[model samples]
Target: MPKAKLKPDVTVFEADQRQQEAIEHLHGPMLVIAGAGTGKTTVLTRRIARLISERHARPDEILALTYTENAAAEMRTRVRAELGGSETSQMRVCTFHAYCNNLLIRNGRNFGVLDDQDLWIYLRKRIRELQLNYFVRAANVGKFLFDLNDFMRRCHDELVGPEKYHAYVERLVRGELSIPRVTSSRDADSISDQEVLGRCREIDQVFQVVERMLSEENLGTFGHMISKAYELLNLTPELLSQERAATKFILVDEFQDANYAQVKILRLLAGEEKNVFAVGDPDQAIYQFRGASSAAFEIFRNQFSQSKVVALEKNRRSTTPILQCAFALIDKNPAIHATENNDAAENGGRRFQRRPLLSERDEKAGPAAIKDPVHAVSLTAKDAECSDIVHVIQQRRKQNACQWKDFAVLYRLHSHRDMVAEELAEAGIPFSIENMDISNTAEARDVFAIMGAMLAENDGASLFRVVATSD
Candidate 1:
């Protein structure tokens, strides 16, 4: 493929100086610390466009990867628009899973990694075969199975193979051994080794059973795609070189969410050229439950020689008060990134080491000049709080044209859903759950729907649907 033409002068593209600096940096590895609403997707798309248009890079040679397909699609749309809808069709715009899936499909056969089948039935059967039904009630079996599945995936994400997993099991079984690889969570120190050991054994057994079944049935999991692809690349230098040659430039979005396997795979693809452009905000990482490591971004920045680091702190989405609230949380002990050091100026004046946040949005957002309109309401009892909320909503609707959907009640736990749904139903509220499609997966859930219909009208079918996916 021939190289594409460059984008026009500065006047053609209106962006912040820092954003332009990040986009213009088309050479070696570059890291952009894009805070929330700092136009991260915009920066990423524009950066890729600049690489193709201005830097004369072939579209097909560039790979832009995100954590989600939606984000990838959005980036593609923006990049195409930036490049005037020319020379962007072949650019690899996809999620990590999609990218890994493509690589495995084309080249996995030689590595004993072929196609994979559905995991839904395999999971249900495994739960029965392991006698997990006895340990967990039938209603909670789905939760047990799903949790086991997540544990297995996390293990694979950490690159813990079955043997090492079995080792963990053996040590746990013996009840006298030190575990390797301490968890990176803040709760790590407080967690009991035996508890972790028991869970590790459970995860290991699931891994063994599920993997064996997958092998017999010619099925593969998403974890297989990542781990096996890494294995394939490691065992075949020609394949690696070919892959690297095909994609001369790689742009990784949400780099802070990269785990051990992702970091390794990215490094392998980067090769000697190291033409990786990663963008992410460490302060916004919330996927650690899925084995994501924000430190991966820091490690990449620290290891790469002469890597350019750009901080995009300009807030265009939220009010200045909201930014202040968020930054207040981010500026605390663990939230503040190690790279941010305000005292570095006194130490050696090295690049003025600290990079603080800035908000361009108006401070008038919170109406500081006016007295607060907040009020307090006392309920007859704790249970009456629901009635109070419904009453307030009704009042708001009458006075301000507020719809039922205009109000929201967010809970941190799925366990909190049933109570809220019950309250809403009692109050005749028309609010809806954001993601209530759990029962849509697997045909066995049809039985669940039938059972749900047979149950009482107030049995919380919506909550049942959410839980049935796991069951």
Candidate 2:
């Protein structure tokens, strides 16, 4: 028996050329254009570790934020692994909402906001109540209300609160301003001055309800969570100053997915020192549906003209052909391609193209190697029987000479699974459906009962549903 050799852990001094550049350059702002599997996480965690272990940065002052709790946890885990428990324990790695909640708990009262409000729990309920009240009679106002909620949230993300929103409403109601033509859910109306004014009034009504609720009841919406934090930072200058002084560096993960409000929060926290490290790929910006602005990343990068941009060109994930195909697919979009190239070039990627420079995986993981490894075969009710699909699966299993675990069947809609499942069963093939469609699940019905009870105290139906469905 032989013991495997354990290589010495790579120190900051021993970092790869590009990673070393990102980790060592800690003075001002830096943007790392790290593509998928480029070890952006490596750069981020290592940089934080470097600051704690070498630069004498107070762990408390370093704020590392991400879009999701999962990402924050991942970064925290990496930092913990990189710089022992003592150093990582003092640092704050959190999502935007959690970080804002921290500020709210500490300094929100100083700004007269989030002080007595149930911003975290009842915000959604409050918004829904307002929409039901204000737009009860409007046609298809339910859909419009959904969009209005998003529009207001975007305002919050942009650090625009009730007062600023009222100003915009005044202009719109007066026909002095025109709504920008939009292709998003936020697009309400701007057909004519009269129509625009009508829609403006509708929006204003919803906002007025929101403001009154917040001011009188001290209850706020999710929008207020972020915007109020921005407000708290602004209204309490001393607190902001103290915070800026305390925070030496801010590292933002998935910068491309950051909407306007999150980006603004980071910038304000960065303050004049501008010690922020943001790592993201513009090509990977896919949060457009929920008010994320990919342009926010580019705008921030350009704001600091002297900010060093490092491109993590080599990818450790996908094979070259797959990367090439992805590049070509995304490059077809003129806007995305242009943004990627421009940012990459500015970020010191002279040879930067719309796609990432990919390397070989341990084994081939590309289209060329796997000839239609998975394909969807459309079926009609009249198309023979389920055997068509089951037989295909069987043939593929035998041809590839793989086990049942190696094969998979996916459905776009969950209900569509039953028919294929029945076929699989009849064919004596084993299969499993991955995602849950709550409508067909007892657990979901129980949840509905609970939510229904919360929404209406006197709803006998929901109450009975809860009692009857109880395990």
For residues 289-350, write the lDDT of model 2, one tens digit per residue.
65665476557755655677677777676666666666766676434312333455667444
Candidate lDDT (C-alpha), each: 0.69, 0.67
Q: Which stretches of candidate 2 lie over 4 Å from their true place?
A: 1-16, 84-87, 108-137, 173-176, 179-191, 334-353, 362-397, 401-471
For residues 1-471, what per-residue lDDT tens digits would candidate 1 score against the true structure?
555654453434457888888877766888788888887777788778877776547789999889876788888877887776684678899988788878877874422222112344456645666644233543677666666667667777877777887886797678667664345658777867766665566666666877776566455667777887787888899999999989888899998887778778888998888888888887767777777756666567555655766778677756655666666667662433334222343553243132345655553344443332335577778677666776777788899897777788767667667777788898777777876656544454556545654664533432334343554
Best by lDDT: 1
In candidate 2 the C-alpha lDDT for residue 27 amounts to: 80
Q: Give the count of colliding residue pairs in each prediction.
A: 4, 1
TM-score of every model versus the real structure: 0.70, 0.72
What's model 2's lDDT at 98? 83
Could you tell me the TM-score of candidate 1? Answer: 0.70
* RMSD of each predicted structure: 8.3, 7.6
